[model samples]
Target: MKKLRDGPMDGDMNGNQRTHNFRFLLALAILTPLVVSMTVMGLATFHFGRLSVGELTGTIVQQTVARVGAQLKQLQDVAQDQNRLNLKVMADRPPRAGDFKRVAAALAPSFEVNDELDGVYYGVEATGEFFALLRGTNQVVNLLERTLDPDGQWSRRISRWSGTDWQFLEQLPADRYDPRTRPFYQAAKTARATIWTSTYEFWPHRPGDRRTTGVTCATPVYDGAGQLQGVWGVDLGTIELCDYLAAIDPEVPGYPFIVGEEGDGTRRVIAHPNRNMVIDARTGMLFRDANGIRDETVKAFLRQIPGRFAAHAVHTASHTVPLRLSEFAPDSVAARTRTFEFADHGTNYLGGCFVTGRDDRLLIGMVLDKKEVMRHVNRNAAWFAATFAAVLVASLIGVFGFARRASRPLVELQREAHAVGRLELAPSDPPLSHIREIRELGNAMALMKTNLRSFRKYVPADLVGDLVRSGQEAMLGGERINATIYFSDIAGFTPVAEQLRPEEIVEHLGAYLQAMSDGIAQHSGTVDKYIGDAVMAFWNAPRPNPAHAADACRAALANQRQLDRLNEQWRAAGKPVFRTRIGLHTGPVVVGNIGSEHRMNYTVIGDTVNLASRLENLNKLYGTRILISETTRAEAGSAISARPVDRANIKGKTTVVTVYELLCEAEAETPEQAELRRQTEEAFAFYQRGDYARAAAAYREILQRWPADGVAAALLRRCEELAAKAPPPLSQDG
Candidate 1:
């Protein structure tokens, strides 16, 4: 018994596996039930709470949609009803043709009463006579009337109403101004009833006046004798509608807009909180395409409108059909309110759409971000979670204080291991523990951190960190992926290296490499390797980047900017300036840790890498600073400015590749640089078409404008040589 007690239950062995097992089991047993019960209860509460919140938010959105619909109806109905009233009154007692005074007096009260009315007009179908009263600048009444001039020809006169009299503003030359040819006039005459016209840009009263998009409500009036007399119309532009929608609580509850749909399945934004968003400056018409919209939020909403509305469409036995505005009855409760949900740019949104004007096929829509709706619920949930966590922690602390003390060193070692896994090797002291295994774990983590710190210098820290965090082992294999490869080299680097001392060369080259590496890393690019003065980098590897090409181009431009600053400093010190050239190409390549099992490199390899290297060499022949493959130029899109350089067959590649000289970021380029690029591209096009003479002339023009343009000079010499080798054109005498 004495031998067994001394051998097995000794003090030294107590701190071994038994102590660790006891501490771990004790803590796990005590904390399991407490943590599990609290987590389950919290999840149950959150699930039910979220359901209740969603229902409440849906109701709020429905009400908001109804309110917006009501407001739109009130605005649109005024003009329609006014046109009907004018038709009825005029039909009761037909007015004579060209009775401008009586028509203006009759329409003045209705037009002035409603601030939404942009204008009111009367047209005599029989005599081709017309008169219009419009709310001009500052709400001042303006008139456009057709009258006989002294030359006995019809002329349109523009005048401002001075409350009691009309003061002439400007007179337009006679061009047979006839309202009978207008769309509203013809539609009203054909229907012989009140109807709404499609939106159109109203002609500005003055040359510099802003144009506005408006719709007209037109109705034909007949004489008591049953003879056709004339048509009366009322105009309503989007200005008032935009202002009313803008006045709504746009930031918190929802953003409101009005969309108009035509019978032919065309949709347009008629009114928005941002008035300018709906108005197309180029055509002065309503925005029909969501792509042309400047506001990102509005564009996103418009893009989702079609899909969301189609999804909620009333389904039939045979096919699913979207609910159209024209299908809704004017006064139907269903027409006045409906709610739906959609996601835009990863954010969920709740919205309401209701038919505001069936005749005009307009629907009022309000979009509310889900984040805003759930904000209060989230805040309350956070408070409840915090309170519950605080109580649970307080209870567990007292119950497990002794167990926690026994295991604190192991916990510290676990944290150290996690830190090392993240490649956060900023020198930390190893945790001291009485337990043998715990001390061993801490030492292992310290040594790993030290090794990774040195390993990061050879391999990219990001690549290694990603591999470690994902728990993936570095293996000798790769996968084909679309990536952008970048290569850069200093111009005349060999000669420059020879001129400087070994230490001086190292200092300058070291700073240059560091700056280039930093620029690449800043754009999520991995530095594959450094070949003397040349550095090769790649993007969309280890981490996926959808915009890898653009990122690479931006990094190249940034590196150039960085070199400019360095050169300024070097110039002040009378040191040799190192002009660097960059090349970028985007294509599918094999990227991963590629080497034997014992030694591996996280790099890319393929024809794309070779082409990128070739492009850097071509920059010297073209006298350009940066050249990129056509694939890279296309992937980068309009974010970077580049001009076509030339097409050449890459070594070992059967197909010819087009190249472009990357200038600078599109937004950063000056007008002069843009012009130079434009001329160079134009000349290159001529050269490609075998018009060497014209190409030479274009290059000469470019040189005249930019005297120090080396690219123009080089291309001009090439054009002259090609032109001299060409056979003379056949004489016209033949």
Candidate 2:
């Protein structure tokens, strides 16, 4: 006599936990040896394979170093290409004072796309003038323009973009900084091609403030006549290079650095993995202070190398070898494309170097601690041995425990099925199972029980039982049965969705749908589908409901009442209220499962379904909530109050059908509602009879009483148009 509930299973099954545990223990005993054997084989391969573990580790380090070098070269190439393109665009026309803003706007896109570009500038050789746009922290963009005034001193103006437009920040007094004197300008002007400046401190905002190490990519600008107009340059920050390396593999015990040859041929650290090493702490600037070179690992390595190369020296030997500037000479080992191992601080390390830039003055290198690089491999080997033993023990315990818990649900399901076979429709809940197959079986059994109890809501309970007992399948074909179809839509739902946030829309729509579904279920109706804020349903499908029309009418009425209560609650909470409209039609239509084999929906469809949908839309025209066809009104009898609204051939149909507005429940109609319905019907009747003047008078009266009555207003407008039109074109044709 136990009944099922909605949710997970209720009670434990007959099998004891100890019995299932024993089964699991037996399974674990069978699997443990296979797992251990696999682990041992893998460890043996690592220890004595053709490719030794050390070689594999070394290959990985070499590949990583190569990738880092490639990325740095690619970055520089992008900067060069960007500068060359900008210079071409700017030099297309002669440099003019008025064209500075337009040129900067053109270059803005390049800066925006390349996050590493610190700034872009154009210098004019014809005039002592320079224009630049710099990107600052937190999305701040600053424009700097240096111009020579009548007094022969440089004036600088700074401006910032204020989202919509540019706003002038300040104008500084004359300064001596000239773009022609800068290294980037001189190099590009001399080469007449793209060139990279040596890394230096770039502190454009305020002197002695925060400084960052960066290099500039510059290209000479030429006018149409082939005259050197000026130099165009882009500053690229090296901090991004450090960040790029840090993000490569933080868990690895290695670092990357870029060393470039100084003007004096001495190698200087340009980009370091530890950014602070290249930054001068005193001024917070990069490569500005000599003390900044202290503690820099690559510089330290270079310093240890003797000034002169020893003859026949073994540079590739594992023993510590000094890395001097001479080793980076054209044919030295440090400049060659290879990796070497050396000892540093009693720890063996591996270093690989690659030449970068067209000038071959830059070496991109990575140094990894030998012990740290092997740490993971060594730890993994130890973990493999310990884990195999522990897994062997734990598997036996876990399998036994899991087997006991997993079997209980299947046992309980069997008992429930037995009870169901004996005509005992009600049975205790099946136990939940964690195993996939067992859970699926439990779910099937639960679905069977639910169908047995709730089938009457969808079809006649007696017929369902008969089909089950006879073991016969319901045929796929539908029958022409007199049934009532209902459709409801929330008004202004699109706007409502637009106004509410995503979560709020979900919450409000959920509550609205649940309220409507509950109302339909209360009247023994079957919900077909929900399309957004609309619901479609029907009654008397597989079941013979003699009062299906009345039932649908009652459900629609109850649905409105539920919405009214919800609207009241929403209004009190300062939330928007949803107004719903319902349309109902009763007719002989095909009702059955209709769709492809993979997916089928047991619903009603035909001209009757379309009519119901159209009727729902008609509510908007009449300014009413619910509308029904003449057939539904007749079948519904006096249980519901309705008034004739209009008769028209709806779209996709040739025959005209009469439609009525559902006023309310017969007993719940207010006196004022009754009076409104009477007046509306009277006006509609007068308009239909071709009494234009009287109809207009009647509609006017109705509008005076209910100014918002859309139907009345429409009819009144039609009557006025008819009266205003001259006698007729028919008389002229005659």
Q: Worst ten-residue run, lDDT, model 2?
A: 305-314
Candidate 1 lDDT, 68-162, residue by residue in tens? 65566566578777877676556466555345656566666666668888888888877777788888767788777876656667877887776
- What is the per-residue lDDT of model 2 for residues 1-734, given as tens digits with 9 covering 90 to 100? 35433233434476544332345455666667766776678677657643465565556555665556556656766777787678567656745556777777666666766876778888888886988888866857777788777887677888776554557888876666678888888888898877777877664544433667678888887766778888888888777766655566624677767666665565556667677776566765566422347554565445444232121133432322122233334444332445667665576777666554434556666677777767777787777768767876786677656555545666687687775655467745557766677778877887888777776455534445556766776656678898899999999899889989999999999999989988987898878889999999888866788989989999998999999999999999999899999999998889876776666557788988888999998888878888999999999998888877777678887988888888788889899889988887887776666666777888899889889877778778888898677342232245
What TM-score would every model get versus the actual structure? 0.54, 0.45
Candidate 1 lDDT for residue 106: 62
TM-score of 1: 0.54
Candidates' C-alpha lDDT? 0.78, 0.72
Please tell me which predicted candidate would have the highest lDDT against the true structure.
1
